[model samples]
Target: MKIMFVGDVVGHNGRKAFQKYTPKLRAERGIDVVVVNGENSAAGKGFTRKSLDELYQGGADIVTSGNHVWDKKDVLEFIDQEPFLIRPANYPGEAPGKGWCVYPFKAKNIGVMNLSGRAFMPPLDDPFQKVEELLREMEKECDLIFLDFHAETTSEKIAMGWQLDGRITGMVGTHTHVQTADACILPQGTAYITDLGMTGPWKSVLGVQTDKILYRMQTCRPVRFETAEGPSVYSAVIMTIDDATNRATDIERIYLREEEDGIGL
Candidate 1:
C-alpha cells in the first residue's frame, strides 16, 4: 500500500497549493491514501470546519493535527463526529475527540495514531509511554500502523522512531515546519523522518510574514502573527508498505514549489 503524508497546511495559499498539487501527485504516483496535518489550515493559526472540508475535497483520506487543533474553538463541536480526524493521544483524557483510528482498507485495518512530544512543548502526558499504550490497543485490530508525531525537537522524534522500529509501519514528524533530510528506514523495518515540513508561504519565515517576525525579533515585543501571501510550497512524504508483512519498504520526501528561490543574478 502506498500512503502519502502531507505536512502542515497553513493558510489560504497552502490550501491552494495542496488543492492544486495533491490530486495531480496522487494520480501520477498511484498513491492509495493521503494523510494531512491541518492544524494550521485556518489563516495559519487554527483550523475550522471550512478548512476541514477543503482538505477532504483536496483528496485527504484522513486529517491529523497538533497543539493548535483547538485554536479555532469551534472544533470542539465537530471533532468527535469526524471519524477520521484525530488529535494527539497524549492530551488529557477529558479532551474531546479521539487520538487513534483504524482505517479499514481493502481487507486490512490500517491504524493511524497521532501524538505530541512534551519536550519543549506543552506539558502533556508522556509521549513515550502514551504511544506504547496506544500501540498495544491498536495492535489488537490493525494490520499496519502509521504514526504522526507532532513534536519540537528532533531528538524526541528520533527516539520514538527507534523505540517503535519494526513494531509499526512508519512514523513521520511534524510541527517544526522545516523539512529534514533524514528520511530513512530503520534497522528493523519502520520508515521514519524527522519532519515533513510546512506546506505554505514559500518565502516567508515558517508560515508567518517576514516583516512580522522580523519586527518581533528586533523589538522584543509581542505582535499578532499573520500568514504570508503569494506562492506556496507543498511538502509531503510518500511511502510504500508491504501489506502482507505490515512493514514499510520505502520512504520518499516531496517538496514542491512553483518559484525559484536559489536563482541569483
Candidate 2:
C-alpha cells in the first residue's frame, strides 16, 4: 500500500496549498490513503469546523492533531462526535476525543495513534508506555498501524521511532513544523521520519512571521502569532508498505515545488 502523510498545515496558506494540490496528488500517485497534521489548521492555531471540512475536501482521509487540538472550544465538542479527527493519546482519559482509530483502507485495517511528549511540552502520560498499551489493544484487530508523534525534541521523535520499529507500519513526527532529513526505514522495517515539516511558506520561521517571533524574543513581550503568506510549498513523505511484513519497504521525501501543478511534483 502506498500512503502519504503530510506535516502540520498552518493557517490559510497551508489550507490553500493542501486544497490546491492534494486531490490530484492522491490520484496521480495512486496513493491508497492520506493523513495530514491539522493541529494548526485554523488561523495557525487550532482547527475549526470550516477548516476541518476544507481539509477533508482536500483529500485527507484522516486528520491528526496535537496540543493545539483543544484551542477551539467548538472543536472540543465535535471531537467527541467525529471519528476522523484524532487528538494525542497520551492526554488524560477525560480529555475529549480518542487517541487511536482503526480506519479501513481498501478492505484492510489501518490503526492510527496520536501521541504527545512530556519533554518541553505539556505534562502528559508516558508516551512510550501509553503507545505500547495502545498497540497491544489494536494488534488484535489490525496489522497496519501509523503514529503521529507530535513533539518538540528530535530525540523524543527518534526514540519513539526506534522503540516502535518492528511493531508498527510507520511513525511520523509533527509539532515542530521543521522537516528533518531523516526519512528512512528502521532496521526492523517500519518507515520513520523525524518530522514531515510544515505545509505553509517555508521561507518564514516555522510558518510564522519571523519579525514577530524575533520581537517577542528580544523584548520579552506578548504578541499574537500569525501564519506567513506567499507562494507556499508542501513537504511530506511517501512510503510503500509491505502488508505482509507490516513495514515500509521504500520511503521517499516529496517536496512539491512552489506553484507546482500536481502531487507528483
Candidate 3:
C-alpha cells in the first residue's frame, strides 16, 4: 500500500496548491491513501468545519492536527462528527474528537494515530506512555499502523521514532513547517522523517506574510500576521508498505513550489 502524508496546510494558498497537485500526485505515485495535517488549514491557524471539508474534497483520506487544532471554536462543535479527522491523542479525556482511527484499506485495517509532544509545547498527557496503550488496542484489530507525531523538538521526534522503530508501519513528524532532509526507513522497516514541511507560501516565513514577521522581528512589538497570498509550495512524503509484512519498504519525499513547478499555477 502507498500512503502520502502531506505537511501542515496553511491557508487559502495552501489549500489551492494541495487541491491542484494532489490528483496529479496520486496518478504519478499510485498513492492508495492521502493523509494531511489540517491544524492550520483555517486562515493559517486552526480547523473549521469548512476547512476540514475542503481537505476531504481535496483528496485527504485522513486529517491530523497539532497544537493549533483547537484555535477555532467551531471545531469544538463539529470535530466529534468527523471520523477521519483527529487531534493529538494525549489531550485530556474531555477533549472532543479522537486521536486515532482505523481505516479499512482493501482487505486490511489501517490504524492512523496522532500524538503531540510536550517538550516546548502545550502540557498534555505523556505521549510516550499514551502511545503504548493506544498501540496495544489498535494492534489487536488493525493490520498496519501509521503515526503522525506533531512536535517541536527534533530530538523528541527522533526518540519516538526509535522507540517505535519496529512496531509501526510508518512514523512521520509535523508542525515545524520546515522539511528535513532525512527521509529513510528505520532498522525495523518503519518509514520515518523529521518533518513533512509546510504546504503554503514558499517565500514567506512559515506561511505568514514576510513583512508581518519582519515587522514583529525588527520592532520587538506584536504584529498581526496573515497567510501569504499567491503561489504556494507543496510538501509531503509517500510511504510504500508491503502488504504481507505490513511494514514500510520505501519512503519518498516531494517538495514542489508553484513558481517552479508550473509557473505559479
- Model 3: per-residue Cα lDDT over 159-249, one tens digit each: 9999999999999999999999999999988899999999998879999999999999999999888998877889999999888888899
Candidate 2, pairs of clashing residues: none
The digit string of per-residue lDDT tens for model 1 on 121-233 reads 99999999998899889989999899999999999999999999989989999999999999999999999999999988878999999999999999989989999997788
Better of 1 and 2 by lDDT: 1
Clashing pairs in 3: none
- TM-score between model 2 and native: 0.95
Measured against the true structure, the TM-scores of the candidates, in listed sequence, are 0.97, 0.95, 0.97
| Runs of candidate 1 exceeding 4 Å displacement | 260-265
Give one clash count per candidate, in the order shown.
0, 0, 0
In model 3, which runs have C-alpha deviations exceeding 4 angstroms?
260-265
The total number of steric clashes, by the backbone 3 Å criterion, in model 3 comes to 0
